[model samples]
Target: MRVLVVEDHEELAETVAAGLRREGMAVDLALDGPTALERAEINGYDVVVLDRDLPGVHGDQVCRTLAAGGSRARVLMLTASGTVADRVAGL
Candidate 1:
């Protein structure tokens, strides 16, 4: 499966990509929201792992924009902001 990881934390992004690669998945990394959105728009991915907070744009905005734009890839948000409101807001 091809996955796009959108994260501002460099080490965490690298770690996640490495782990996904070990699982035999194709992975691409984007450090912030604009790059993430651009990459997602151009590539057909199986899943998108997005951070809740980002630079250039917030991850929540990216998720909403992608959904609004009719992106078919599944999104699984990975964020440190673990709260009901935060999760709901991302959706």
Candidate 2:
């Protein structure tokens, strides 16, 4: 599967991408929200591993844009906040 790993943390992003690659999946890395959106626009990704608190556009906005643009890629949002409210809000 083709996956986009979007995280502001460079090391984490690279590590995730590397792990996905080792799993025999095609992976791309995006450090921030805007870059993630740009890459998503240019590439057909099966999944997007998105960081919720992104630098440029924010993960929710990125997901919204993708949905509005009719992208079929699945989005998995990650966040440091583990609160129930945060999880519900993200959903």
Regions of model 1 farther than 4 Å from truth: none
Error (Å) of candidate 2 at residue 11 is 0.5
Which ranges of candidate 2 are over 4 A from the true structure? none
Clashes of each: 0, 0
TM per candidate: 0.93, 0.97
What is the per-residue lDDT of model 2 for residues 1-91, given as tens digits with 9 covering 90 to 100? 9999999999999998999999999999999999999999999999999999999898999999999999999999989989999998899
Write one digit per residue (lDDT tens) for candidate 1, span 5-83: 9999899999999999999999999999999989988998889999988999998899888899999999998888888
Residue 79 displacement in candidate 1 (angstroms): 1.3
Best candidate, TM-score = 2
